[model samples]
Every structure is written in structure tokens, then in C-alpha cells.
Target: MITIIKNKTLKTLALCCALGVNFALSGCGAGDSVQAQSNPSTLATKDLSAFVNTFWYVPQAYTLAYSYSSSTNPKTTAVSDQTIWHFTSANGGYLLGCSFTSTNNGASWTSATIVGSVTANNTVSLGFFGGLVTVGSGILTSSSGQPAFLMQMSSGIASTGLTHWAYMLPITSSDPSWSSLPATNNVSVPTATASGC
Candidate 1:
């Protein structure tokens, strides 16, 4: 009886140990699965600088069409005929400034400013300048004399080159707008006088 009882107790202990080991191994497996699911593309700051240095001109210009929602039922309106200027640094970071004319309800406004920055992946954060009237005669200045809209770009930077780029602008707290446009990649090279604008 004693011998049988000892063997049974030993078997129980061994079973518990096996269970513990299995649980530990399973836990590690689960952790690895979670890590895999969290994978995201990331670029270091150094890589961004290298990408920017390759371009001769950091500033470029493009035409953009901007659309926005109205206060009433129509919900949206688009303004085309806008000019945008963009600047990029050596680290693949960029800034854009834009101006345009807008007409609503027979009232016309001639200028709007959008300022923002971007990363190599074309991710953008944008802020809009909301207060200035297009036809105002007074000197317009913010109380703080700062830009009204500010934006930053965070994704799609790697896809940008000398001729084309993907960009984004934050239109509101909940909405971000994106665009693609033509760019002059090589500013150092001389071109025909007709190409000058």
C-alpha cells in the first residue's frame, strides 16, 4: 500500500510539472504572435536626410484643387485655380504653403493659406488659415502674428521623387485630405527660356 501511494503521488507531481511547462511554452508562443501583428514600417531620421539631399531644389510649386464642406445643405464645394508652394529639407521632411481665390454666396475671397509638413512616407498634418477675408482692406494679422493653419505630413514620404509626390493635409479634427502633384526635381539644370515660369 505504501509503495502504491508513493507512486501515485509521484505521478501527480509529474503531471503538474508537465502542465506547467506546456502553459509556459504556450504563453511564449502567444507573445510572439502578438509581436508579429504589431509590425509597422518605420524610417529613421538619417534616412530622411539622405533622401532630401538628393534633390537640387528643396522648394517646388504645383496647382491644387481644394474642396470643403459648406455650412448649409449642399455639404461640399471645390476651389480649383489655386497655387501651392512646397519646401523640403535634407531629411525628407517638407513644408507647403498655398493660396487661392474662393467665391461663396456671391462673396469672393482671394486668398487662403495652408501650412504643413510631411514625412518620407507622405503622411501629412495640415492646419488651415481661417480668419482672413479675401477682400478686406485692413492689414490682416493674427493677434499672435502666427500662421492660422498648421499641418504635418507623416506618411508616403519614401514615394516622393523629383517629379511626383504624394501628400496629405489635415482639413479638420476628423478629416485629412490627400493629393498628388507634379514637381520639378532638378533645379540645378538649366532649361530653355520657355520652361521658365
Candidate 2:
């Protein structure tokens, strides 16, 4: 009888362990990585306009990229400068493909995909915190029957009156590929409607 009880106790313990792991892995407080943003390095301290482009559409539904510079010159990723990729999904959700940290002010780019929500609206809310553009959220409304889309951000480092920015660039596919992407100067400013998200 003792042997049977021992076996049952072990089984119960194993089940509990599995449950705990599953809970941790689940998407909770997933607001643009509400958890990961706890790290001070990933916050968007730059203007975020250096990498923003007010385009009409994301051609081919390609992924987008953004980079931040803590100083006119940086030599380490820990100085709090970060790069993020905005990935569009077929499921109508957006994400960061990988993360890049630069102490060199992006002298050479590396791969890093810090997960988070990039934008949101009353109907669709997406993005994670602690992202290079964590405080930056926007609306992505595509044209009817066309890939042409309009992106508008409620919060950007530039909006907060800063020079350096966390802006966007195009990556490979609309799919989430964590390869490499470069920031762009092509980001533009467009007339936008108020964010209702």
C-alpha cells in the first residue's frame, strides 16, 4: 500500500510541475511584453521618429524594422539603445520578429526579437511593452481589397519631443522571420485620425 501511495504522490507532483510551466508560458500581461519591458535596456528612450515612415501601405505585407540610438554615438547594446522589427501576420496581428542591441549606435546590426504589441485600436489591440517602441502604439488600417495601409502612432519618442527615434523598415515577408533588417529614413509624417484603441 505504501508503494502505491508513493507512486500516486509522484504523479501528482509531476502534474503540478507541468501546470506551472504552462501558466508561465501562456500569453498574459502580454501587452507588448509587459514582463520583458521590466528590463530597463529595452525601453524606447529615443525620439522614435528617425525610423518612422507614414506610408500608405506595407508592400507585399513585408515586415517592418525600427532602431533607437541612446547617444549620437554608442558602443554597446547595454547603453539602452535597441532595434525592433514590426512583423505583420496573416491573422491580422502585428509583432516584433527579433531584437538588436547596439552600443555602437547601429554601427553593425545583430539579431534580437523582443516580443511585444506594436499598435492597437478599439477593435484590434496588439503590442508588447519593453519594446524599443513600447510606449508607441498605432493603428494599421488596410485599404479595401488592396494591400495599401495607413499606420498612425499615438506615442513616439518624437511625439514626446525627442530627436532620436524608433522608426520602421521593411523586412522579408509579412511572415515572422527573425533574420536581419535595417532602419530606414523613408519614414514619413502623415495626417491621421485620433486613436480610438
Candidate 3:
């Protein structure tokens, strides 16, 4: 579920969502952060070997929700949309293909796309239990070449089991804040729905 809110509210929601997922999976506190390391060569053999060519995505039912409303009326309306993600390996990295299906409570549907590439070396360390993290650039296929970004992570904990999460958002070509969006929106503890190239 995706909601449209004022800019401020949206930012708050994104942060809350990210922190919520982080804490739920690994007990990360408000101050805890996902540390990124670009040199994959320096990682341990186990860490490097953990990543495999697989397909995973956010289950439609678990998508983030969004709502809209009038400030004076105190009433809000929400629309739910489902996003499906596909990942493939390329050039020692990963290629991400995403499809956004807008549905009217499962009545109607509209699909959109965002394509991205995750370089092998552009990674984040989430500890041995958390697994590998991949970050890279993306583009909204429907837009006028609007640049975007993506982050993918695999995590496992005895309490919550295993899960895979991916996040993508639009960014200005020169946006210095691009790196922060993935970390901030890395919410949702959805397990990989399927596995394949």
C-alpha cells in the first residue's frame, strides 16, 4: 500500500518505516546504521559467497500503504498499489527490473517500471547474520529519464526468520542525498517470494 502525503509527512513515514523494519529484524536502535563498504574484495569468503543469482520481491499484500486527505477535514483516503521486483546478474553486479501494479482493491491494475543496476563492489555490510547488501543507480522507465537509486539486502534472524528487501526512489542527477534514501526507506521485512534469474 502506498499513500500520498505532504512532503514532510512522507519523509517521516519513510524514516519510520525503515527504522521499524530494521528494529524488527535485527534490533537496530535509532542510532544504528547500515554501514556501506565499496571494496567487495576485503569482505570475508563467507560474506562474498552468500550472494547468489536469485529473484525476490515485496509481496503485494505487504506493500507500504499511502493515504491522502484534507488537513481541515481530518479525513483521509488511501489507495493500495503493488510493486514486483526482478533481479539479474550483470557485469559482476546486478540488474534490477521493477514493475509497479496499481490496483483498485484488486479490481483494476496499471503497471510501471523502474530499471537499475547494482555494482558488485557497491555493497553494505549488515553483519554475518544480516547477509549482503547491494546499492546502485536506477531509472524510472516511464519518466523522462529521471534518475533513481536502489538498495537490496538479505537478512535472517532466529526470531523473524529470513527475508529480502529492496528499495528504489527517484533522485536528481546531482543529488548528494541519493545514498541516504535507500538506507532511510529500507523498510518491510518481506521474504523473497521466489528464486531464479
Q: Which candidate is the best by lDDT?
A: 3
The per-model lDDT (C-alpha) reads 0.28, 0.30, 0.32
Ten consecutive residues with minimal summed lDDT in candidate 3?
188-197
- Best by the TM-score measure: 3
After superposition of all CA atoms, the RMSD between model 3 and the true structure is 19.9
TM-scores for the candidates = 0.28, 0.26, 0.30
How well is each residue in 42-154 modelled by candidate 3, as lDDT tens digits? 43322222222332333333444444333424343333433334332233333434332322433333333223333333433221211322222332222235322233332
For residues 1-197, could you state the per-residue lDDT of candidate 1 as single tens digits? 01111123556545434555323222322112111121146553123342221211111222233334434344433323222322234323433334332222112333334444444434444433534422111111122343122222111123221111212121212321112212322211222111221
For candidate 1, the lDDT comes to 0.28
Q: Is candidate 2 or 3 superior in lDDT?
A: 3
Candidate 2 on 1-197: residue-level lDDT in tens?
01111123556545434544322322222121111113345333322232232221233233233333445344122232323343322222334333333324334433333343332231223333333343333433335443322333222364231112332333333423222222222321111111101
Residue 72 of model 3, lDDT score = 28
Model 1 ranges off by over 4 Å = 1-32, 36-42, 45-83, 86-92, 101-110, 132-197
lDDT of 2 at 196: 9
Candidate 3, 126: how far from true, in Å?
A: 19
